[model samples]
Target: MDGGGDPQVAGPVIAALMERAAGETRVAMSPETAKKLIGLGATVRVESGAGVTASIPDSEYEAAGAVVGDLASTVAGADWIFGVAAPDVALLSGAKPGAKVAAVFDPFRDRARTDAYAAAGYEALAMELMPRITRAQSMDVLSSQSNLAGYKAVLAAANTYGRAFPMMMTAAGTVQAARCFVMGVGVAGLQAIATARRLGAQVSATDVRSATKEQIKSLGAKPIFVEKVAGIEGEGSGGYATEMSDEYKAAQAELVSSHIAKQDIVITTALIPGRPAPRLISDAQIATMKPGSVIYDLAVAAGGNVEGSEPDVIVEKHGVKIIGFSNTPAHLAADASALFARNLFNFVSAFWDKEKGEIVLDEEIGTAIRLTQDGKVVHERLLG
Candidate 1:
């Protein structure tokens, strides 16, 4: 337990972690996340006053079932460790070899650090790398977080746009509903479409996956489908969009530009995990959009799906507003945390062994967990 920061204030992952510890397990938690853990059933250990940042008093953990202790001794005998972010190397040095460590390691971005974890003999489970399979839905942290991002993107776009989202009848005049275009029909994109539609906006969406067209239509939104290219199905394992050929991209881009110019608000959620987001809207396309239109790029962290997107900043070019929000999910921290925490709990439940005081990786469930195992990085697509 690093006790780096408070978990209650950080996200619901802490609450879920606490709840999971309730079932016949003697789990230990850092003071930051321990107060909630104690209430669930496990005995917690805190270092003096670890939950002060989150306004959780040290005595609260004790009342819930925790003991205050030194940080070094807390890690010395712990069989398992859990966290939202990866632990620092200094913290890792304190843990015994072969400890089952689980966290959002960001293995794709932090390859070197993950390799170091492997070399040190720690079984590091990267939550971000969980496969997008039916069985793994409960453990899909990325989807859980992105669902919030999708909802938020619509709100942000509505706020930025000068017009109202819904059509309104007033004494002054009749206001038409705003037209919103969503790129990519993934989880985030679909949610954006639904949110926009709920706000009474006339929503339309596009995706390389032909299968998503019906889903979009079912949500009472129009689905923009360009002509399918030969030899291109636009599908990938784990429910991700595959990279398109240059010719396919050009064709799709041309078709999208005409549709984009008519949209009052555009929310782009196109992203390929561990790769740069495909560039869907070019500078010229942005120029063609209505002067007061707003474009919210949800993929801004991965180089953006729209042109002129700058992470955490709103840029105006030729009277069109481009919003590039890096951590859109953080805006809804409480809900995001809860969903993420549940994801972590579901993932760890498969391995938790209360009586033996150890973790046994189930081959089926652990298939996704063992991205890096046996001194090697082993994701099916990530591995060469």
Candidate 2:
């Protein structure tokens, strides 16, 4: 199965492969994505049937100039490996000694697994750490995936709610639009606002960062906030919010409780990278919410914003429904895979040299996501 490759010499050719992890429905690369990667003058190998769950066939991959093979042959001597999720160490048994892997590895959540990847002599680029910067925008997997989640969250709420999102003029009587309140004005929250608005819902949003108020308003949604909070400034580096202090949390909760009680749907997207998701919705606030209200907590996997949310489950509490759909992007696997693959292709083509057939890891964003190098955990944040 060896493809006769030398690590230093073959760094230019990358294998956008797949994993056999059960229930993982997304593939890192599609047929069209393979074609784009090949245009960069790199030999691309796609494992046969890798994209099957995504509705892409082996013939399509081959037509796009990719070598179709089993996992062993596909990863054979490949210096670089790209995937939707990090492959299990067992899956990498046939990989080269120092193969570089780029994927959504959830580094902070699985510190031990990340350490194992480093100990196994693999250099990892955790796509979740892709910095929010102009240069890295085209390659930001988190935004691409989270954009899907935000839109879908609204749809999930709309579908589950007994009432309609838009006002209906029935012959019997006029029905008012559903009220939606989204907390967290990041990519997901903004998308949720846009989707809910499009569905004709009366949407309002809140964020710790006052800067996001303009953005929320731009989307025709009201920005709700506690004007004065002791600790939460809603400002941070790399275009994401930092953690809020206890004092700010207490004050914000008091302000939000009253507003939440009147809403029909509440979608919480507040999250701080490398930290447990903040509790934005309390048990008491949830109990007071209108009966039949829907609460979709996007951060449930990272602890949760709602009091009783569980990862990937839908449960009712206090006459209200809490929908916690884990890996939201994966629910829309085909389209999600397509967008994710395109982002992966952009990231690789950025550093790949066509004529010279060389790989350059000079992108500043690359350093941020690089979790291991030369058989050691290298990223400064991960070191802690």
Candidate 1 overall lDDT versus native:
0.70
Over 307-377, each residue of candidate 1 has an lDDT whose tens digit, in order, gives 77998888998799999677787666556655665676566555555664334677766767665666666
What lDDT score belongs to each candidate, Candidate 1 first?
0.70, 0.85
Per-model TM-score on C-alpha atoms: 0.82, 0.95
lDDT of 2 by residue, 213-233 (tens): 889999999999887764344
Residue 377 local lDDT, model 1: 64
Residue 70 of model 2, lDDT score: 88
